[model samples]
Target: MYNQAMVIGKFYPPHAGHAHLVTTAAAQSGKVAVLVLGSRFESITVEERVKWLAAEFDDVDGVEIIGMRNDCPEDYHSDEIWKAQTELMRLALKSHGVTSIDAVFSSEEYGDRLAAVFGAEHVLVDPSRSAYPISGTLCREDLGASWPHIIAPARQEMATRIVVVGSESTGTTTLTKALTEHYRPRFPGIADVPEYGRQFTYEKFDTLRSVVPDAGIQDMVWTAEDFSVIGARQNEMENAAADVCPLVIADTDSLATTLWERYYLGEGSYGSYHAADVLPRRDLYLLTDHEGVAFEDDGWREGEHRRAEMTEWFKEALTAEGHSWILVTGDHDRRLKTAIETIDLIVAQRSGFTSPPWASRSSVARPALEGAAA
Candidate 1:
């Protein structure tokens, strides 16, 4: 057993393999130090990688997490390059009050050279990767497929944000719930963001009615400031949901609220909301059409007369903002199928991994509009 052992990696969204290497080293040594090394060009930030690693080993004793910005050459075969990188790692360890290393643990052949540079024994774990059978390159290529191998939930590298938006009585809420249920079985980390605008409106119902008699329901006397607050809250809720899941289904986003503000309060009112800038960018938007759906007045609805018009407004607004959206026009079951298909495609594209067998089933096809903004 060694007194001090060290393991270093880019941890480009640390997965289970990285965890195994670190834990193995910790078990063999009195003190195990983990060094997260990355550059600005990497997909995920070094801070995020450190956070993920630290969170994973928080309860473990004698484990230290150290972060470093690496600026060395990418080619590891060069002897000069290896020596230079090892020197930098030595300096970093010394700065952290770690003077000497008894062992250097790694999953790569470079461990031998690195350890030799430090005059330490090389402890290689799973050099063939047969046990973990995963890599950072594989994870980056297809996040959905590599999701199960990811040790930390917070490090969902390619989390897909899907927003369900449409006019009132268009089954946005119902579809959102169904979609969440559908994906949860395959991706257990799936989550959904509730309609924050409706929540805010309902929570402040009595107060608004007291101020204005016609304030009950969606007829409340709201201003641009009120919409701004709602948009901000909605964004906050969406981000909270995204943190825990690889796929987040939002009932509605700030962009939908901006459309509502423009529809009721006119175009000038929406400029103040800044929905595009404030709201988190969604991977896909499912626009529910109000053509066949009967507009049921839930007291908050703007009546059945303007349902089609409002639906068109949503499409126009989404298009103007250069959002990737698909128009779903069908019954409840058909709408659900379309949503599932669209989301599966997005998951595949973003993660470079194919959808599961069940999610691969074909559904009603629709042409997706892409990049329409000015």
Candidate 2:
């Protein structure tokens, strides 16, 4: 008989201790299955809470938290339906290469019954930090008082993940969107930066012109640099929540701002404004070609050659800095297709697989799946 481990719990917000138990049980034998008793309903949706769990833990491996569909009436909890659910869990374990439950890991009352069903030994793990050793029902009633201490003890270390960056009107937004649509269904985790062009254009473009008059280069430069800083900071703070996230597709990286400062300043005024130290570092850089895509005529200086020149200059600067940048050109659809294909290489380099993001990046063993940025 194939050896297996069985674990069960409500895991309202499956904390670190529960995660540790799940991983340990799975490591003991062929497979480890976790049965979530009250997984379906709560104030917070089950799906929303699970994502929080994945971010809380760094990696998702060999852990399965099964949820049951609502086949019965919402007003009643049927014993017949629940017995069937438990039996289905047992069958699922057997079908998924689990023969015996090496241990039952829990800090709840149902721990014994969970082990007995599988004929597996029950192990009481140290629930040192769990909110309530008895159950979460009483504690959740007046959550305002006991909530913080229960689930979130204090601050936890965050994952310092990298974000991609580039310049505006330079295809940063399009590329990020393309990469997301390209790999969303295939990858376990993905991230992207918010697009500021449309936002800035829609909200502040007119107001700045009327008020500042001489807004000139300073105005546009301020807009670009300011947005760059905001975008990078926002990404770092949120993406830090997950561990081993697939990759973050940033709209505009820091170097783009450096390039902007270099472009606006005349006669080597690059050192006068600021240095490039503040820009957040990225694992990969994708430089976009300027093909006379968009133009700003009324407010700022406009020329086709100037746009192309800046694109060329930024690429050269990035190249000198020992960074990798892919030059993508053509219309939106054409450029998007090229970007999706090229990013496949970047993802491959990270995953250690030669196949594309569509064909690879996902694994049968990888459980605790989390969606990309919403």
Candidate 3:
């Protein structure tokens, strides 16, 4: 076993192959430093890749993950470029008090030269790619097909999150369910997160009924704390769903729960509002319009007359919060079609990955770098 080892890669999305390389290094070394390199040309940020890998290997001992931006042009033939790249790698390793590496672990051919620079031996693993037939290039080319290969933390960031929210009886649940069904063929693990507020409401009322058998829905009191609980649970459920699927549909999100807090606990209430500020990023929101849709008088629902007003509140809050949203109208079928078209466009746009300069820098032009920023 080596005293100190190093692994270096762009990690782009950190697929299973990268994990294997890191784990292999960790197994053979007392200390393994994984350098996550990033370039401006790439879409995924260096910080995000570092965080994902850190989480992925949190349980593993002797693995240290570090992120650094390296915009140096890829020219293995040039001694000058090699010197500059090795200096950056050394600085990153030294930050973790690794003065020298005994071994350099990598799947690339340049591992020998990198190890020589650090006065370390080269240890190549899976040079033929037989162990895990995946790469950053393959993941960038077809993210959906490579979903299973990506680490869970990275998957959460890459997933296309669609949230359906609106006032009561406006078909938010129906639209979320339909959207999940629409994307299930391509994203088999995709699922719609049910409204936690509704479930909470059911339980709250049941608890009240246990004490007073004749208690009705109107007697149920909604406090700021209740909305906060709803908002937190919504975020947890959404995150759990996104971890397993590349696409996740939700009936409502924490952001929507804030407006409901105002609706039930008066306009000044901001308990749920602050709680939702730290929730995960959502890609698209579909607001179900209350027009032409008659409100159903469910025994638990008392918002038929206030549907339009609450719908307007959702629109205003969504815009105020700087979230991307679209209004869905007409019959259920038409709404589904409109949602599908919009989501398909978003998914297509997000899935297109720009390879780092190291991969295909010849075709792409990069601005001259003044100095090393990492």
Candidate 4:
């Protein structure tokens, strides 16, 4: 086993090719050092990418992530980037008491990159299929297409990534992991949309409630606040796909937010919506009934019959908002199968696309380089 390995990349957005490098390194090296290239511009911040990768690879013991800031300006072109980066690796190796074990892994400019840092013995890896070289750039371009079929097959090699959000434990997390297994997909990029209710047990919940007219915060938490989070979250997920579909199969999303509005407020409170104000919208949205899954409160969820009201309200809400969504019932097994198929259907649409589909504008598009590109 390679005791120590180094992975270097800008990861402007970590796509499938990026995952292949890390997945291979984790398998080959006893420990992998990921030196992320830093940026001088104010666009996507370093902290955001670091956090996303951390969440994605939290379970891998072999991976050690580090960020290398680019202090030099764009005009300051020097072959020295290769030199300085290599020296950093050599120092890391020496400190670890590692003479050398396996090799350096990378996607872009692998020859000069590994040679500059590790030596001539650096092995070149083509993680993508021999014929098709899937790189970050390719994933970025394809994402705008929102093609699920081509994406689904490409992601088969990488670990499964899922974001579960909905009322109580409607198997959001359970189903995410289960699908990950049933699929045996690469999962270095999986993350659970933290039960936002729990995330703000003290802070955000209290803060929102203080201003919220209804103390029925428990019922509406998934909606009002979560919508803001979900939209922001999906935008981030766009950049993180690789070794996983750019698809973000949400457990619950704006549809639920609308239901929360209808349930807590009057029938007229729910309003029109769209995500990112773009076409070729979210791949899939799975809304579950409380019937299949029993509601258990860890002090987060509050409702007597969360079964039909929320589900019904959501159907109306989704239709009014003009988003393509499916309501899922039955036990976990049946619902899981539906979700899988639904995602497949969405992916298939991406394969054969004419013109981009029209989508309602949810909000203004923020500059991608602003804060988070995860």
Candidate 5:
């Protein structure tokens, strides 16, 4: 039995396989030290990867997570390269007050060389990867295919949230559902977060009123505190959904709540809703235009006349925040097509993959939306 053992890896997003390797090492040693080497060019940041590791091993005793930002040598077989890399590893361990290592655990052939350098025993764990059957390369190539191997909560940053925001009866919910269905096959864990503000106003409050005649519920009379609660609840729901999926289709977000608070409760009254720090910025926003679309009176809609004005308010709010958004107009089919094409472009840009067929005819160029003013 080893007193101190160490494991090293890039842990690019740290999937279940990596977890198994670390946990196995911890079981054989009194204490297991993990070194997470990260590159500047990787999709996930070094800091974010470290947080995932800490969270994953929070309950496991004798597990220490350390992170380093360093790229691997260009020539792996060069003697000088190996010597320099080995020295760096020694320094990293020493910095953590771990001067002596009894064993080095790994799943790669390099485990032998690394252990030799420390004059420690080399312990290989699942070298063939038949046990966990996953790799960072597989995850980078296609996250959806490797979803089963990922830890759900650690995927929050991996999620691309596309929020549908607009005035009342502008088909935000319809478009949200359409987008969720369209991307379901490509992203199995895709989710749809329904509008929480509407649920609060139409459902929750109605229930309260039924229980008490004068439930202190005045129609269209909401305080800043009320809007704050709505904003907080909306954000909470979005986060919960994001934790489970790689892509979240939100019918509305706190940005919409900010607009509603300003429009109904007055401009400065929405001060409580300006706490954008707590809100998650969406990757894309599909602002449904009100032109040529007949307003269907949802029980909560203020009036048809306010639809255009409310749409403008949403645009101004989004523009003020420098959010990436595209104005989606026309009939249901056209609107859905535009949204899908835009989302495809976003996914392609993020993953460095080929765009879908609809992306070829995408309306707004990528630069224009990305460079929009705050």
Candidate 6:
């Protein structure tokens, strides 16, 4: 057992393989400092990487995850470049009062040299990739294919969220359900979050009926507080779905709630808009057009006459917010096809990541630096 051990990586997005390496180091050493090195060129920020890993290992004993910026160029053959990079690592550890590493844990070829620099013993773990058959490169190349390998926080962050919005009975629920079904075969855990606003409406109407015995949805008044509750619940459900699934199809989201509050309360409402302001990042907004689709009352909808006007409001709001959205028009089949194609394009585009400067060289053999390069 070593007194102190060190693990270094780029952890561009810490995956299962990276977790395995850190746990192995923690098991063998009294304490392990996992240094996440980031460069200006990478898309995944160093602070985000640190947060994800820290959350992943929060319950584990004596494992410290830290992040530092290392802009030094990658060169396996240059001693000067190695020295520059190693100094950043030393400073990151020293800030936490960690000194004199007894072991250096890595799955890369640089383990020997990194250990020598620290005057620690080199301990290699899963150099063959037999333990977890995944890498950051594979994850970057195809997020959908490598979805299962990514850690929970990264999975939530990378998950593609498609929010279906529009006027009442505009097939928002129908489309969200269809999209969820469409992706479930490839992404087994894919699921759609039902419209929480509708549920809130049902409860409100139910409560009203109990008091008057003849009260209808029309009789129930909508307050700013009601929309606030709906907005908060909508965001909660969407985030919970994203935590476990690669793709989340939300029937409606907090942003949609903001518009609904404006529609009902004559605009300038702060309750639901405040909820929308803090919502997690949403990928796409799909507006189900009310032009061709007939609105069905379903005993709960009171906005059939306002369908066209509401649709226009949604389009305007989405445009003003600079959110990516598409109007789904035509019959159900055509609409489904258009939505699928658009989403496929988004997934493909997200998967194609810009390689860090260190990975641009093909001659340099790729080693598992956890998520970094040595």
What are the clashing pairs of model 5? none
Candidate 5 per-residue lDDT, tens place, 1-374, comes to 68999998878768887999999998999999898877666666778888888988999989998887766553457789788777777877888999999999998877898898899999999876666767676666666666556665466666678899998888889899988999888876676689888777876577767877676534445778877888888888888877766678899888788888887777778644654557774799999999978889755566588888888888888899898889999999999999988888777765553222221121223232223211
For all predictions, the C-alpha RMSD in Å is 10.5, 15.2, 6.9, 16.2, 8.8, 5.2
Ranking by TM-score: 3, 5, 6, 1, 2, 4
Which sections of candidate 2 miss by over 4 Å?
A: 1-170, 187-191, 195-245, 266-281, 292-303, 331-334, 352-374
Q: Which digits, one per residue and each the tens of the lDDT, describe model 1 over residues 1-374?
A: 89999999988768878999999998999998898887765656678788878888998888998888876765565778767777778877888999889999998777887888778999989876766767776666546556666775444334689999988898899999999998888777676689887877776787877788675575567788878887888887787776666688999888888887787688788643775576665798999988888878776666578778888888888888898899988899999999888888887666553322221111211111011100
Candidate 3 on 69-172: residue-level lDDT in tens? Answer: 88988889999999998998989888878898899999888889999999999999988666677777667765766777788889888888889998999898
Kindly list the per-residue Cα lDDT of model 2 for residues 1-374, writing each as its tens digit: 22556676545544444666666666664555665534333433445444444454335455655543322222114566557756666665656556566677765445676667667677666544232232233223322222222333111211122333444455666666777667656643554556443445445556776777766543654444554444455444434422324355666544554565465554443431232454433455666666646753444344445776777777787788877666767777876777667666654544331211221111211111111112
Backbone collision tally, model 3: 0
Best by TM-score: 3
- For all candidates in order, the CA lDDT equals 0.77, 0.49, 0.85, 0.51, 0.77, 0.84
Pick the lDDT winner.
3
lDDT of 4: 0.51
* lDDT measured at residue 351 in model 6 versus the true structure, 0 to 100: 54
- For candidate 6, write residues 1-374 as lDDT tens digits: 99999999988778988999999999988999999998877777889899889989999999999899877888889999889989999999999999789999998888999999999999999887777767777677656666767888777777788889989888988888888888899777776699998878878888888899987666788899999899999888988898767788899899889888888888677688778988877788899999888868777777888888998999889999999899999999999999999899877665556655576321212343333311
lDDT value for model 3: 0.85
Better of 1 and 4 by lDDT: 1
What 10-residue stretch in candidate 5 is worst by lDDT? 355-364
- Tell how far residue 75 is off in model 5, in angstroms: 5.8
Model 5 lDDT at residue 296: 90
Q: Which scores higher on lDDT, 3 or 4?
A: 3
| True-vs-predicted CA distance for residue 306, candidate 3, Å | 1.5
TM-scores of the models, in the order given = 0.62, 0.43, 0.86, 0.41, 0.81, 0.79
Backbone steric clashes in candidate 5, count: 0
Backbone clash count, each prediction separately: 1, 7, 0, 18, 0, 3
Model 2 weakest lDDT span, ten residues long:
364-373
